[model samples]
Target chain A: MTQPTAAVLLIGDELLSGRTRDINLQQIAQYLEPIGIPVRECRTVPDIEEEIVAAVNALRAKYTYVFTTGGIGPTHDDITADAIAAAFGTGISEHPEVLAEMAERYKAMNTDFTPARRRMARIPHGAKIVKNPVSGAPGFQMENVFTMAGVPQIARAMLEDIGPRLEGGARVHKVQLRGPGLREGDLAEPLGAIAKAYPDVSIGSYPWYLGTGDNGVALVARSTDTVRLETVRGELEALMRGLGVEPIPDPL
Target chain B: MTQPTAAVLLIGDELLSGRTRDINLQQIAQYLEPIGIPVRECRTVPDIEEEIVAAVNALRAKYTYVFTTGGIGPTHDDITADAIAAAFGTGISEHPEVLAEMAERYKAMNTDFTPARRRMARIPHGAKIVKNPVSGAPGFQMENVFTMAGVPQIARAMLEDIGPRLEGGARVHKVQLRGPGLREGDLAEPLGAIAKAYPDVSIGSYPWYLGTGDNGVALVARSTDTVRLETVRGELEALMRGLGVEPIPDPL
Candidate 1:
């Protein structure tokens, strides 16, 4: 099977405006990696209908799965559900099940179920419900696209429900090696040789600096083959020893 | 004149694999926000040539400016330069100025200038230098695209040189209001009314949760018009007070 890949569509003006730092991309990527469905691409777009629709369509067509977060709230600016519906050319309306459940919850809390709150019941036609235990506003699964809340904690909670729906591939393994006195320039030659020798593995050279000068280099090798990952780790350690820069235990 | 907008392309396999959390997007967005060139869209793709080339072309064509971070280091995985050249359909070669400077620096540090180290000197044809004070391997500026180092500090430093090169539009103003016991369900009606009243302004409602339940709602209104921004702020505060929920001083 061709390895299953995923794409994330982050819809919100807050993310693009620099007012809020996005923690969702990393959270989603991390959550998916262990499931053997790596996130290949991620896009953050403002809360505009055309842009959201275009992005949703583009990403849904390409990846095995597409996840969108944000703009699915009880406000005028929360246009994600409508945008998703437009992208798939499907009709959207309030679901009786969700509306009844939400209304009961509000009544239990002694709060009136206003029309704005009722807006949360809107769901695209033919879409499956992605349950929201944290809040009453449920996200929908339209085909391969999984829509969730923008709030980090709620988005995170939604993943528990989503995890079972995915079909994961062979697990990808990663090994990290760090050198205190080493830099990218110092390790580039030998690391390139190792990388060339092992064509199946993906190696990355990351150098950390203290603004003034270099602090160290973090070398990470990733592959689905566990044996090759371990072998690459040995080679990485040997290369660091050859350079006279003892490998640090952890540099993160 | 139409407002100038920016798009950020973050390239790295580490980010896709969830090995590293990206900070460049927020950094670039915050930097450009004050300059009046708001970041409209942002995409993150792994360190692959064709993907990089495609993203570069798509973003460069759509936005006023394109900023890319990552895959510029001296390693086997660093193919951003080649990908950028392919996108622009230009030849890339080692620049004498960059080569000489890097060689001198390596020599002073008592390091050998290997072929891998020499790889850092390559630059695309007709591209101007984006000075990297942190490292000797300077990034390049091709047409409207500004390429910079993947390292956070280096990317931050490169912004100082880039700020003067951009032509910014009218500065956007923002006002934020936080309600302690208020929820989206409480404020949605009035907030929607306000958003409709002020078509030129963009209003956003963000609800923070503590996993179990809602903590509060952060209502933000943004516009280029300062007077409208203040009016929205007042309206937002009144909306919170009308529900008998006191507005919080800070909720970020």
Candidate 2:
């Protein structure tokens, strides 16, 4: 069976402007990896509405599901909800249920239920609520697109709720092989031959730099099949041993 | 005149698998941000050639420049060079100059210049080499697409050579306003008013979470015009002071 694929759309000017580093991409990708729905593509766009609508539509049409992070907040820059609504050609309004939740939350904190604060209650027509326990403002699921908060902690918390909703196909197995003073150029021929020999597992060689002179090559092999993954791991370990460098076991 | 726009493409399965966190997107964006060429969009795709080719063609057509990282190494997974050539419908072969450089470097280091090592010398036809001082293998520029090494340091080093070639339009001025206990919901209305008044400037509100209850909102205003940026900074400072929280001046 073909695995269900997903795409991630990271929204905000902070990320694109380098004011904020994005952790949401990895958070979502890692969450989906074991569930069998691999993230095939990821895009980060600024706060512009046109750009958001275009990216959302383009990605939603291409992938099985689209998970978006950022721009769902109480501010002028928080236009993701409206943009997603526009992309789907749907109308958005403040849901009474969500408005009641926020109102009760403010009452519990003895804070004013101001108009600006009420913006958080707005939801696209026909969208399901993605609960947010960290903050009162809940993320919503508009069809296949799931939108969440931009704050790293809040974004991460929302994923717990998002994980159970997705139906995954193939869980992947990965093995990373590293050795002392290993160089990619040195391992290219042998690694390439092994990659050609086994078409099922994808083998990649990456050089890791710890310091100026201290560096090593990390050989990674990944596959949906665990047996193939373990088999490649053995072959990689033998290859490193042949090169006079002992394979370093992963340090837990 | 409008400033040239750029997009970034980060290739590799490791990135999508969460095996590696990408810092290249921020590196390239920050490098281009001050140069007046803002990174309008950034996409991450796997080592698959079809995905790479599709993204490259789409981005190259939309933006003034496209900066692609990863998949330019000597390993079998390194298909960026070949994929890029296919995107442009151009032929690729081993460049004599690049081959000669790699051969001489390997000879100097008393290393074997194996057939797989020769793969790094393959450059797309009608492309210019981007010199790599760290490794003997160099990056190449094909049309408007600038392809570089995947290694973080190597990718960073290549930008020094990439920066000088592009012409920029406007250098953006940024002003960040933050205060103790500043909340986004409290600032939305006033912030939205300021944003609407100064349509030329893009105003953004991002929450900086220190701990569970120690979060503060960071108000950022960006504009190509310096006078407008300073004007908004004053307005934002006044807004913060009116809220009973003194504005904290930027440390740097």
Leading candidate by DockQ: 2
Residue pairs with clashing backbones, model 2 = none
- Candidate 2 structure quality by residue, lDDT tens digits, B171-228: 9888887777988888889989999999999888877878877778778888999998
Q: For candidate 1, what is the lDDT?
A: 0.89
Give TM-scores for every candidate, taking all chains together and pairing residue i with residue i. Answer: 0.96, 0.97
Give the per-residue lDDT of model 1 (tens digit) for B188-210: 99899999998998898988766
Among these predictions, the greatest lDDT belongs to 1
Runs of candidate 2 with Cα error greater than 4 angstroms are none
Residues A51-122 of candidate 2 have per-residue lDDT tens digits of: 999999999999999989999898998999999999999999999999999999999998888888899899
Q: What stretches of model 1 exceed 4 Å from their correct place?
A: A210-214, A248-252, B210-214, B246-252
**Prediction 2 global C-alpha lDDT:** 0.89
Docking band of candidate 2: medium
